[model samples]
Target: MTTAYISRPASAPLVGIGWMVAAGLCFVGMTVLIKSVGAALPAAQTAVLRFALGLPFLLPMLPALARVRLTPSHWKLLSLRAVLHSAGVGLWFFAIARIPLGEVTAINYLNPIWVTVGAALLMGERLPPRRLAAVAAAFIGALVVLRPGLREIDPGHVAMMGTAMLIASGYLVVKRLSEDLPAEVIVAMMSLMVPLGLLPFALPVWQTPGATELILLFAAAGLGTAGHYTMTRAFAAAPLTVTQPVTFLQLVWAVAVGALLFGEPVDPFTLLGGAIIMGAVIFITWREARARRAAIAAAPDALLSRSASGPAARGSSRG
Candidate 1:
């Protein structure tokens, strides 16, 4: 296994936090742009164009992708990631047209809850009592955010939930791939695959965008790509525990931007619910980091103790 990520620096935590904040801002911008574009373009087409315009950003990383050797296993998982990611992008674009931007953005927080459940069930990761509690808390928070009983549920809500689930699945695949592939390779593959996968569905509804919408589209592409790049940097810089909570800032930015730029209303319930989810995610992330640290600290002592006692035990047996 590669050790490229083993000796991460202490400053990584700070850098990761900053990068995650930047990523959140960029994504908030992307969501606003999608709303501005409205429903004139097909959701699939918007998704495809967003990625197509972002393709140039991946050019410098292609050689890094080329250098990495993909195992058959990695390829299979990457394919799965691409499919799930494509679906998520499509549904999220659809939601942008139908839902308030803040609500749409807040709903995607369910991705972490799904990832937690998935890692336990699919990857067989140990889920202790604390993590289980964290999951439950996060789920409750999701309920508050949805408030299904309070208002009529729309197709937009369903689409956003589905997008979250698909994104969670994609995350698991990427986690598996991270063991063997560089982050750059994983990112390059995603940038390349999203447009290619989205194209067939996008083609039928292709429209000639006006100058204003065209500018928004390009800006959207920039935001989306920059968001991913900064997010990758966040992971590279610090442990997930350090950067995970920072993502909640996206919700704040979404609400603010939606209100100021688009005149969307800010709901008190949404803020409360979002805060609950963010708290749960932060707790879960912190617990995971603690577990990892304990494991790492124990490993070397275990090896040393085993080595030190081995020859003595052998000698005593001979006597």
Candidate 2:
């Protein structure tokens, strides 16, 4: 067991950085696609189309699933994650169709904050003072983004908030299951399950998409698939602490695209709020990395002490 633990390859911090880049690109592209669909396409239909087109990329992974084994607990957890992820997708699509692209992207950052809180509450993970403070800072940033008191909050904003919460919860669940399953299996299951779950809702108002719409839909799906694949590779190579900070780049990309592509205005408040959220998130990740390093350093010494106290040592002492 010790040998196996020791043999686990070091996940490079740079890998995490790469994953962040991929994720940023994927999300920015997704937002652009959503904006292109406009209010003409039903959010549900757009979501269904996104997943449907992405299905092909996952086909090759189906065979790998056969080699993989899942425990009952893993199945249950995966099911929960699938549900949460699907709902989050639905909510996000609705929010994007209704809200400004920059605001939507800014609010989306709340997921990391929610994940931190969920980790503490659900996973019973320890949260030091710095993390707690960071969480508070994040919440404040979200409030600024929403600005509920100054403006009548749109239902889409609420939906986006819900989306963030659901995705964050799903992430914590994925982290719980990461030790047992390969990333591909998890990604494949999500891609497959999203369309399956959306089918019922999609059938109600199924509109035949235009040729241009179809092309955009396919492109969105392809980007999403590729983005996730790159993200997985980065994560596999690096630690979350290294990747978490780079996700901010996505916000920048989204803001630029929103302005240039969609004629969306960049609000100063959004920038300020986003900065607060990013700062808190960075601090939280840094603290966690430091704690992880300390733990790893202490682990070997603890193991050696235990081994030195084995029964053979008592026999030698008696002799």
Candidate 3:
């Protein structure tokens, strides 16, 4: 089954670029907020608060959810995704607390690479030679960033890697469910579910946040939700390949934010590694788009051949 994406208005690529830039800003802002509050609360508690507080913004979509007919299988997949997402967010919060914001953000770029591999393994999609090379290059880039043997590997690094993998798995489920469900419904369900899933873990370490922390958390949630919405709009407006490259700006913003706000020195190795990873991801995205277009272009010919053979096969059977 193919997903029917909502039709978007024909907008200029510039408009998509603008939305993408806004999304980068929002994402960076959210990360900054998370880092700022990391010292005050436990990761799981922060994750719970984020989703719980953000639940109100998602309420408007509840009416839309009523329109979606969800099966038992759909509910199961959604529940699994919720659990994975909650875990990913919890890990991310922990990583942010222990690591530089820039490093955490840079490492998170591994999500797309993980998604590509997940597609191959879970969806049985063929991994072409070019994508295989891209995957290798991405890992090499990761090595450059981490320099694992040179420095003692931190728990934060492990957490971020696990976060990427789990999140990627959740995305795979999202892709499958998207074939039948509206994006709004999928997002809303995840938003509602994450808080519930994280509540238990959060309870043990929960502390009442001060007014400033509360305000910051709320703002971060808003930015995160807005970022996702804008990203969706951008994808709808323009091709994924077109907007994909713009995302690298987030890493730049991350570096700047870390340096200015946290007084973390900019690491050249991390920047180089992030650039390499981004390059590979961009190439993979472009290659996939090309392949998809080729498939679509050949589809009509395949259908025409089948149609032409139909009458002959029927006559042979009759004879």
Candidate 4:
């Protein structure tokens, strides 16, 4: 029950929107850097090195991390999360390097859809008929983006699909761990564990990145970490209704970056599908927040404590 989060500012909604936009920008920037790295190094090696290089960023959080005491259950969940996250990182690296950033970002929107289903089934969160419909619409959005029959589906498409599912799986485990642990402890553990989980995969196909690639990947990793922090700030500052839709701005930035810098074509279908998926996610989040508020209102004393168990407590997963 150690609630570790920033106090909400007076102008909480405005501040939350700003933080959400900043988080989206950081994630888009990270995507650009990862794309710039290309296929020079194996995806697994790049992911392993990215986390390894990110170790320095954890230096400032050392004292907080050191104070943590985990139960055996936390260790088991953490290990499972590490495996999911490690695989996700590798697949994401592979997809970003091969696919247009816009499409990649659009397709990645499926993470929330997957999470919705996973949470209902595993976390015992009730998914009503409407929520199930929303989830279905989100999958349709993925179909709109992929349009499988229209074009040959490449390995990149497959990898990105797997990446979203794996990331959702990791998020589910993190939610379980968050039941008892502070957000910082879960992040610190994953920072270490994901690297270890990735090491064996990296060793099999490792190639030394050039110094320039190393620097770029390091910067990307930093942005990824900062993105997570900003996302947490957004959730802490205001309810999901105010911040969730703002994440769509990332699609705009990703598309712009892809075309402007990489000379990639602007894909209209990606944009449309991204909007579809984002709309579904926003609707789902709003419904959850509204329901939680109603429950809190009915029995404030009984449910107020449970409110802390939400995302504001769990923090955002790494990009």
Clashes of each: 0, 2, 0, 0
Worst 10 residues of 1 by lDDT: 1-10
Q: Rank the candidates by TM-score, best first.
A: 3, 1, 4, 2
Compose the digit string of candidate 3's lDDT tens values, residues 1-319. Answer: 3435566577578888989999999999999998899779889988888877788888879988989889999999999999999999999999998887777877899999999999999889999898999999998988888899998888998999899899999999999999989888999999889989999998988898898888888999999999998998898788888899999999999999999999988988889989988999999999989999999879877977898899999999999
lDDT of 2 by residue, 193-254 (tens): 88777778778988989988888888888887777777777778887767777877887887
Taken over the whole model, the C-alpha lDDT of each candidate is 0.86, 0.84, 0.90, 0.90
lDDT by residue (1-319, candidate 4, tens digit) is 5544566456499999999999999999988988888888888888888898999988877787788887788889999999999999889999998889988999899998899899888878899999899998898899999998999898999999999999999999988888888887888889999989989988989886799999998999999999999999998888889999999999999999999999999989999999999999998998998998888568755655678666566675522
Every model's TM-score: 0.91, 0.89, 0.93, 0.90
TM-score of 4: 0.90
Question: By how many angstroms RMSD does model 1 differ from the true structure?
Answer: 3.3
- Between candidates 1 and 2, the one scoring higher on lDDT is 1
Better of 1 and 3 by lDDT: 3
The candidate that wins on TM-score is 3
Measured with C-alpha atoms, the lDDT of residue 306 in candidate 4 is 72
lDDT value, residue 307 of candidate 1: 85
Worst 10 residues of 3 by lDDT: 1-10
Q: After superposition, how far is residue 81 of candidate 4 from its true place, in Å?
A: 0.5
